[model samples]
Target chain A: MDNNKLQAKDFITIGIFTALLFVVEFACGILGFIHPYIVASYVIMIPIVGSVPMMLFYTKIEKFGMLSIMSVLLAIIMFVTGMGYLGAPLIIGAGVIADLIAKSGGYKSFKKTVLSHGVFCLWICANYFPVIVTADSYRKNLVDGGYSTEYCDNLFRAINSKTIAVLLILCFVFGVIGAFIGKAVVKKHFEKAGIV
Target chain B: MALKLDPRTKLFMIFIVSAVVMMSATTPLLWAVRITMTMIPIFLLIAEKHYAAALRFIVLYSAALLISFKFLSENSKGFLSAFLVGYCSIIVQFMPAVITAWYVVRTTKIGEFVSAMQKMHVPDGITISLAVVMRFFPTIKEEYSSIRDAMKMRGIMFGGGNVTDVVEYRMIPLLFSCVNIGDELSAAAVTRGLGGKVKRTSVQELKMGGADYMLILMFTAALVFFVVFKYMK
Candidate 1:
């Protein structure tokens, strides 16, 4: 394919992905399965999944410039769309780190992709830590305000312990699954699409 | 029609509202003002035809409020106050960002936005990764829907069974699928020369126009006013 045509195709793909992410996030939020920490995790994971097709496109088409373009766009959307201003910067940082890891692993290998996602997962843990700490403090404030100390204490414990455990499990399972899917799909689609 | 102002302006407005709301705890008046401020963003979202997005915000805020009220207070007095504080803080913090995002996505082409970022000195590899993720989000969603359909076809009723059973068997698998999609996305980014070291120039240049400057100034003024008002108490 011509370089221009390839660039256009990549743009379309990115737009579609962003829209999908918005829909999934909205659905999860409405279903009550999404909390602050989950939102953080989900946003961080997006680039990890997105990087595969991006790399494929770049490799095949030799249109390396497109990647930076996509990142800025994604960052702006995340920042401006109430994902939190910090989210955009954090994602940008995570993307940079993931990219470096990918490069260090010789970008062409599956190991690079998997490692990048793993790094993203670990980096996003910081986002969740604040919520846990805040919940703890809020609970303490409630106790001081003469709320049932036991109940507040229990809630705090639930959030700090059980909630964290569940989140960790989710991260591990999702990270591994995302890695496997990326490997399979990239090998199947991009290689055949004649883009890689 | 509600927020016709620039996104940068709206962002400033949110910052001012948030500062005022956070400064004085246990104040119904402050909470009400903050709540009313939050309504403006929702109105903007609706005006923009993003009703689903607006509804999502309402649900999230409502849940946060309920939790704060139920857990933070012993009496009705404290409950209402805590709820307002909790809810208003989130709205105040997030609303402007959402409104700004809506404006950007609606106004600028995605490519242009990405180009602007590159011009501003973001690394090439990082930029590419961000783009791919944004790009693949929709594809993943479609994939998820198809998977969900397949599961339904196989008689897997989503959210209709025993809570534990649904969580253990159904929800877990669905979440796992999302992870699988992420993996695919990463591999695609790597093969595309995302981490390559070639200096890149984007077609878009995010210049600070006069309007942007004016909005920033206004934001600064509002922030100052909020600070003064808080300390005066």
Candidate 2:
């Protein structure tokens, strides 16, 4: 029974950090859209791009359920705004796992922080899963929503193809690389500013 | 008198619409919904006296809706088709929902919303964070513009500069300030005793008036009809 009660300050901290998540995520979204050609691949790089800010945030707010609530809110907004549906349920599991990892080192250990974030990055893959795996339902929703089946089929066929396995594997590989980079960036920048 | 639907009512409308959009409820219903959803933003903007903006939004939404309908009905092939079907179509689908959300965010004061949530027995944790999020986004927009201006003075062009350099210069400083401001906000919130265990009260009256109830009733009936209709068909 983890009975740690959050205070007003904690809520404020949560608010700020949640907003920060949106801020960084929104910034990255802009970059992804700018190139147009790399947008698909850029979507894959989001967890890596987003992990930099998450590093500082995780260190600053190490309490349980902090990341969980953040993930849930972000995922819900994403789903509602037509971003991804699978992210919400998938995030709850990832949030708990990340929380456990952070708890192991009392959140102060850099190695634990890096590892926690590495696992946390897995939530980024949730949005892509339905597109890649349960693609029929994905197509069904669009068609149901007034899009033509022909369009949905043509559009998603490449993603629904076998390259999906490669995409999933690359997600983990990027997670490892991204978390290490996040760990480094936190030390290099945030620590000096005492923001972390 | 101009319509003064309670913030909660507005939320309920948005919520049901979102659910309909999410479920992809039924095709005939969805055709009606697409038009109805587009009207929400128009009505909201007009209600707020944003005449020009309302006109612009309706024009763009209608145009995108038409473009999507045209392309989608065709058996599109290759990247152009893929992009239109995959990307543009999604945008077209989400436009009304996005615009409705934007309207709600723009029109509703956070104080009223929190009070409404309180009346609805929302946990303080959720309400507090929601309040904070409501406050923080506009600040970020302000911060973003200031950073852009500062970068402009320093010869860091967003459009022309090296992409990585632009990101580093732009994002790092934004994150830095965000952290600093976050700390400051926490400190301020603490001073105000925002995290206290007692029930927080608000001056705003969250009245579920007759009109509100009527609207909710109608919405529920329509939703039920659609779901049943989908099953029957």
Candidate 3:
């Protein structure tokens, strides 16, 4: 593809991808089965899984500039939409970290792509650490307030019990699935279309 | 020259105002002060011929403040003070950041901002990510508008149904699309040379000028005073 045409395609891809991320996050929240924590987990994971397609597009099109632009854009959107006060900083920080990992692994290489997702997973895990602590505090508060042992037990069950464990496992499994999908889609479409 | 304050300066102002607002939540006087402080950037933006952008910021912040306050009030006792504190702190904390970011984007080119990050020893991955985020904002906004339009065409009534239904059914799709977009974009970034190892340079340079230094100092002083005053009680 000529340089101008390639640039236009890259821009369009970036636009589409940004919209896709927002939509997926919204859907996860709407599904009702996933709690806010799970949704937040998805938000953290999506970017990591995203590394695959990013590498594919850049490799084919040779327009590396979009990476930085997209990272900033995601952070701004999260912040403006009132995701959280820390949303912008976290997105920016995570994006940079993920990018560095991708860079170090040699962009588009299998090792680079897998490591990027791993790094993203670790970040998501770390982000939820505070929530775990908060839940523990709430549990203690319930106990101290003379709530029934059953109530306290249920509270713990709600957070650290079977449901949370199952959810976390699901997140990890889905993350892996996303990575694979990213790889397959990029390889099938962009490469075949000769748009890369 | 719009809102020509340095980012560091604005950051300091945010720090001070947030501290004071958080500390004296029930005091109407403090809330008034907080509101006035929040207005500084808005006024500056208006004076600098960026009134429309300033209004957009106001609307966004106000919506966030209202939602949070409503939720807090519904959920907690002694919520009045907490709500006041929460809203005041939000305005104080976020307005300056927004203003500073606007100034950064307007005065300096993206390339220059990247170079500035480089000079400050920010990692290449981070620098690139920051750039991507800046570029992504407008695109996402456009995407949101398009989705909203599509929903309207489909006769997805926004407010005519059960509130829970509207949020669950209508809003979810829009949000899902955003996450999907992020997934695609992240992949695209990796394919590009974003994570490359060469010592990268920018097309423009961000230099710290005297105005920036002065603004930083003033903001720092204000923050310190507010913190000390609040804590002394």
- TM-scores for all candidates: the values are 0.53, 0.86, 0.52
User: lDDT per residue, candidate 1, A1-196, as tens digits?
Assistant: 3433334344444444444434544544433232333453553353335334333433432233333344445555544444434435545665566657666656566666566555544433333443464565555545564454444444355446456666555554565566666555556654565433
Superior candidate under TM-score, 1 versus 2: 2
The window of 10 residues in a row where model 3 chain A has the poorest summed lDDT is: A122-131
- Which candidate model has the greater DockQ, 1 or 2? 2
Interface RMSD of each: 8.9, 3.7, 10.2
Writing each residue's lDDT as its tens digit, candidate 3 over B96-180 gives 4555446445444555656666776764544555555556556566766787788788887777777445644543444345445
Question: The CA-based lDDT of model 2 is what?
Answer: 0.68
Superposed by TM-score, candidate 1 places the C-alpha of residue B103 at a distance from the truth, in angstroms, of: 6.2
Docking class of 1: incorrect
Which portions of model 2 show Cα errors greater than 4 Å? A1-3, A27-43, A83-86, A129-134, A137-158, A161-169, B24-29, B159-161
All candidates: TM-score of chain A: 0.53, 0.74, 0.56
Rank by DockQ (best first): 2, 1, 3
lDDT (10s digit) by residue, model 2, range B34-107 = 56756855786798887887887788777776776677566555655555555655556567667777777777
lDDT of each: 0.50, 0.68, 0.50
* Model 1 lDDT tens row, B187-222: 664465443445555445455567557656755665
lDDT of 3 by residue, A1-196 (tens): 2442224335545555554454445344344222334444553345434434444544532334454445565655444432333434544555566567666656657666555554443323322333354565545543443334453353355445345555455545555565666566556555676544
